[model samples]
Target: MNILLTGGTGYIGSHTAVVLAEAGHRPVLLDNLSNSSADVVDRLAQITGTRFPFIEGDIRDTALLRRVLADEGIGAVVHFAGLKAVGESVEQPLRYYDNNVGGTISLLQAMDETGVGTLVFSSSATVYGQPAYLPLDEVHPTGATNPYGRTKLHIEEMLAELAASGTNWRIACLRYFNPVGAHASGLIGEDPNGIPNNLMPYIARVAGGRLPFLNVFGDDYPTPDGTGVRDYIHVMDLAEGHRAALDFLAGSAGAGWHAFNLGTGCGYSVLDMVRAFEQASGRPVPYRIAPRRPGDVAACYAKADKAADQLAWRALRSLDDMCASTWHFQQRTAR
Candidate 1:
């Protein structure tokens, strides 16, 4: 299968590109380098021992997408391009809507024009706003608390409508839990441009002495340790999920859309992550407790049964793997 991956140079997409190549599929990467680096292409080639084609552009450019789709002989697409900061989304909702939602619309239109019907979309656990229950499943009610999540929900609705239109499209909406980790090789990993928005990276930075201290957000949540708990799926496992989704789409003629929650099915608190990272990096992650972020959930993990049964995929990496791999990437990049 020739898979075209939007945002392919980004964290998860880059890992998935390696997974796809290892699984005997060709991956053509499309990225603008707005949030990622083209240097990832070389790193991927070194890791996978194969150089896949990459187009440098945005997903909203329908003309470029269509041309790439035709020229690359793309059989499927994995859409990973979007703005994903919850706080930033609140500040600039239109940018999130325009980039995330608008990008999907343009990509779909281009797919329609180019006769490409298979798509795998990157959805987020943020769609399950407050998380009514302990472990969120695909059937969990969606009420996005922020604009970034709203764009994900809206695009999911669009995909549902498109699937219902009888257009021969097969779509999979993969709702990812907290993705935190790097490639095992420590070559390519999560490299946020500025202050990190997520926990693992912040801990890594502080441990590496780049940042002074970790601000442990809200040590008084309802969880056991009074800290927010989340399911942290390794980027490698998450990447394999994409390969399974593409395999399912290529082999099945299943009509309407289907969604799977990709996670570890185990919840780990922020304190747990900090401790694990400290052990992995052999550096004390100094920290101070702070007030809870407004929209922070007390606890949120995933059931993950649907993905295992439907996609025949299960997360094989453990929390130790997650922390150790992340530390490797962090230390290497911090150099």
Candidate 2:
């Protein structure tokens, strides 16, 4: 299967590309490199022992997307292009709407024009605002609290409407939980341009001595350590989940806008991640407890049975693996 992956140079996309290549599917990356580095292509080739093609452009360019679809003979698309910072989105909602929501519409239009229907969209766990239950399921209510989450929820609604309007569409909205870690080879990983937003990366940075201390956001949450807890899935497992989604879509047994939660169905607190990072890197990570950021839930994981039963996919990596792989990549890339 020839797959066109938008934002394929980004963290999750790059890992997914490796998995796709390993699964014997050809993936042509389409990225503007807005939040990622072009050097990832080289790293990918090194890791996979295969050189895949890439297009340096945005998904909003319908003309370019159409041309690429026709020229590359694309059979499916994995949409991963979007701005994803929650705090940043609060500051720039219009940019989030224009890039995330607007880009999806343009991509769908191009796919419709080119007669390509198979799609695996990168959704988020944020759509479930504050979890109504302990472990969030697919049927949970979606009330986005932030602009970034709203963009995700809006695209999901659009996909549902589009699926209702056709039978040829096979779409999967993969709502990812906390995605941490990196490729074991240590060649690529999550590289935030400015200050990191997520806990794992910030912890990694602090342990690596790049940052002073990890800010434990409100160690007063109802969790075991009185800190916030979340479902932290390894990037490798998440990458394989994409492979399973693509395989499921290619099988064509299910139809319409199907959704799956890509998580481990277990929650780990901020202190747990900090300790994991310290153990992984052989360093002591200092921290200070700050007030919980607005809009942050106390605890949120996933009910991953759906993805396991439906897509035949489940996370296999442990928390230690996540931290070790992430630390390896951070150290190697920093060198």
Candidate 1: worst-modelled 10 consecutive residues by lDDT: 247-256
TM-score of each candidate?
0.97, 0.97
**lDDT (0 to 1) per candidate:** 0.90, 0.91
Candidate 2 lDDT: 0.91
Off by over 4 Å in 1: none
Query: What is candidate 2's lDDT per residue for 68-117, written digit by digit as tens?
Result: 99999999999999999887898899999999999999999999999999
Best of the candidates, lDDT: 2
Q: Count the backbone clashes (under 3 Å) in each candidate.
A: 0, 0
TM-score of 1: 0.97
Candidate 1, 1-335: lDDT as tens digits: 89999999998999999999999999999998887888899899999999989899999999999999999999899999988887789889999999999999999999999889999999999889998886898888998888988899999999999999975899999999999899978988888667888888889889888999988779888889999899999999999999888777766444569898999999999999988988888999999998877566788899999889878999999988998998899877633
